[model samples]
Each structure stands twice: as C-alpha cells, then as structure tokens.
Target: MSKPTALIKFKAKLSRPATPKGAAWTFLVLPAVASAKLPTRSMVTVEGSFAGQPFQATLEPDGQGSHWLKIDNVLREAAGVAAGDSVALEIAPVEKEPEPKVPADLRKALASNADAKATWADITPVARRDWIHWITSGKKAETRGKRIAAACDKLACGKRNACCFDRSGMYSKGSMGAPEAAE
Candidate 1:
C-alpha cells in the first residue's frame, strides 16, 4: 500500500507518570487523523516537530489502538516542555519500514548459532525487531551479552523472540515500564 503523506496536526498534552517509581517518560498521544487507521502493535516512522524541535522517530502503538510520541529528555529540553504542558505537533507518516540495526555482539552470536540464524531469517520483521530490542535494551554490556546469549538459545529452540516482552510500549517491561501501568 502506498504510504500516505498527509500532515497530521494536533495539540497534545505532555504527560508523565504520577508515581515516583514509575518510568520517567513523557509523551504525546496522537489522535486519529485523516482516514488512516494506524496499525496496532507496529512501528510507524513519523517525521515532525514537537513544539518546534524537528524529530524523526518510529512511533510504537499502544495495544489500545493509540500511538504514543515518546518525548525524550533532549526533546523535552529543546521544546521547553514538561509534564502538563500543552504543545502543538505536526507529523507525517513515512512509508518506510524501520530497520532496527543488529548490534555487533548480537550479530556475532547469531552468526555462530546456525539454528538461531535460520530461525531469525524465517521470523517476521516485527518479531525480528522485538528480538533486536530485547538484545539492545540492556543498560550494561554484561546484560546485553547475556540477552544475546539468551536470544540465541531461544531461537535455537524455535522461539521467535523474547518471551513476555511487549514490543508495543503499552505493556513494556524493559528499561521503561508499562505506560498504562504508570497511570
């Protein structure tokens, strides 16, 4: 299908979790624009400006049929926005599929594991993205190495991606916790 290029403009509130222990995430929940029904649980590249700072990111769908525009620290600082702030956003969906780059360590591990390599090749792009995300989400080198090993083991056993990992931010358990759970 041809990727639609209509510019979606909206006003969104910058929100963060109320709990102190929750992830320090800030984002904008985009409203439905035009006739396009954004896909659930998939990455969609968006090019836009949040409060005037240009940005390009792959927006992750929240299982509930909404997409979140995660505002990182840099973006927040640049935009001079914080929790409860309202900002104007302009975005256009890019048709290109985001290709998550495989870390060198994970690439080496996958190369050494023949079964894992074959399984990785057979899995869908979304599944591959999950595996790549899981492998790279580790905060430390040791943690990343362990995740890579675990991924190979799971793939060798015919598993497509990490178990219990929510590729969609709706129920993420990685560095950032579930967005809904924080609310």
Candidate 2:
C-alpha cells in the first residue's frame, strides 16, 4: 500500500464555539492542523464563502512555526460566522519563507557610531548597510585601512548614534587644558 495524495480540496474549520452577536475577537491563531502535508514554503490561496458570495485569502508562514491566513476581504463582508466563528482554513503549498530577524551584533553595528549626529543623519539603517558593505566588502588591506582611522575616530567620540554598538555612548564634556605660560 502507498500513502494517499489529496485530489479534491477540503475545508478544515477550527473546533471553536461561535462568537456572540456584536463582539470582537482580537487574537491570532497559528499553524492550523490538517491531514494534508503542507510544505513549509508554498504559494497558496484560501477561499471563504459566505451568503453564497466568496472571497479568496492568502496564507503564508507567520515565522513562528505557523501560517498567517490573511482574512482581510472575508472579514469586511457580512458573513454567517462571526470573528470568533469557527471558520475553516483551507491551504495549499507556497514557494518562499519569511525573512529572518537581524542578529544583535549586526543591529548594534548598524545603530551605533561615534559621530552620532552627522553620519547617523546621512543614511537610513538600510543605507548604513551599504556603507558597512563598502567598508567590509573590500578584499584589499589598504582600502580597508584607508577608512580605519577616521571611522574609529568618529566612533571613539561616542557621540554618533547610527553606526556603533551604543547609540547613547557620549564623550564627557570635561575640558582638557593646561595653565597658559605668560611671557
């Protein structure tokens, strides 16, 4: 005997009691369980039918080990099932997965710089990435060396907020001076 494959699509409704009249259910339900094998990343369309009118929905990975079913259209139209109504979610496979969050070090590198005012203002964090890319993207030592001193100097001041580890890192305002000698 071989494993069976699905031919006809089916609707799987949640086993929840319907919402009371004129009430709002504000919550998110994740990764609906079904008999069909839902591939991790696949393009899928889910349809909702109410009062003989139908609305189509899109389902994608919610990035927390579950799928995000978009109910934008269905929610707007008058339907038999309320928000908490035991709605059925039908699915198909999709092609792409959600993008991952940036690592802490990368975020620190992007957000902190010693020249807290100027360099930070010049570019958005995404743009900072380009600068980071240009500086670190280089394969040659001299090219990287050229930016070393000024970049470090700017960061050392602890004033810049956009490209260093600490966005609030600030240099003390104390003065560095010696008594003047009079002739």
Candidate 3:
C-alpha cells in the first residue's frame, strides 16, 4: 500500500476513560482525522507521534462512527500529557499488520491439534489477535492456561474468536474485572 504523502495532523484533548462503559484509559484522536485515512478495518494500526514522541498504536472505532488511538500510561508519561490536555498528533496508516506474539504454551497446544491449527489459519487476523489477547491478558498463569485450553477447544469446534471480549475497549472494566474509579 502506498503511504499518504501528507501526514494527518490534529489537535485533540486527551480524554480518559473515554466513556463510562469503556476501558479506563486515555486517548488522543479525532473522528475527522481518523476518517480522512479511510481505514479498511474498524481497528487499524497506526504509526504516529504525539508531542514529538514516536509511537505505534491501533486505532479502534468509537461506536459513534469515529476512531480513537489509545494512549497508554507509558506514552502519556513520555509525552508529558494528561487528560484534558490538548496535544498535537501526526499519524499515518501502517501498511502491514503487526502479528501478536503467541505464547509458547499456546503455540505448543495449537501445534498438537491439527484441526485447531487449521481453523486458526482460517480465521481473520483480528480474530486471531483477540484470541491471543484473551490468553495473554490473563492476570494469572492459571487464567492464561485456562484461556489457552479454552481457545484450543473452541478452535477445534470451529469457533472463530473468543466471545465476551471487549476488543473495542468499550464496555471493558479495568483488567476485565473492576471498573475504574470515576474522577
């Protein structure tokens, strides 16, 4: 894919806990800016800079026909930004999708099950990422193992992706358990 010559730039206020039902996180991106890129997928990986600090993130649609780039704590600190602060952003589309790393145990499990492996290959990249995220996001080793086992079983049964996962980050409480304390 050819890269757009003009970098899309915008000034947006950093917002936290984007919505009451969404994940307790901060982000910086406007719908208009995102729309100009004409993303093919709801979630698109973007390479960009915020306050001059280079970063890469996936822009997720905001249900309201707009997209937002999640700003993690690390990026916030690096950029010296806070919620409600106006920040300048320069972004461009990433031509290639970065593959999420599959945990060793999960890899082993998939390798042993040919049917599951075949099914996994048939799923979309986004679906595969959700499964990987579900497995890796586990707070505990047991939780991760359970997720892995469940994924293998589901894949073997021809399931495309994990259900109940808030891939869009909306409706997700922090760490998939507790809600963020309202400010």
lDDT of candidates 1 onward, in order: 0.74, 0.38, 0.74
RMSD of each: 5.1, 20.5, 5.7
Q: What lDDT score is found at residue 53 in candidate 2? A: 43
Where model 3 places Cα greater than 4 Å from the true spot, the runs are: 1-6, 18-25, 103-112, 119-124, 130-183
TM-score of each: 0.63, 0.30, 0.62
lDDT by residue for model 3 (1-183), tens:
575645778788787762566554676556565556655435667788988899988776554445667778888889888887999888877767777667789889999999899999898777887898788878899998899999999999999989888764546654432122235
Quick one: ranking by TM-score, best first? 1, 3, 2
The residue ranges of model 1 lying beyond 4 angstroms of the native Cα positions read: 1-3, 19-25, 32-36, 39-41, 101-108, 118-127, 133-183
**On a 0 to 100 scale, what is the lDDT of residue 71 in model 2?**
42
Better of 1 and 2 by TM-score: 1
Residue pairs that clash (backbone atoms under 3 angstroms), model 1: none
lDDT of candidate 2 at residue 59, scale 0 to 100: 48
| Maximum-TM-score candidate | 1
Alpha carbon deviation, residue 88, candidate 1 (Å): 1.4
- The TM-score between candidate 2 and the true structure equals 0.30
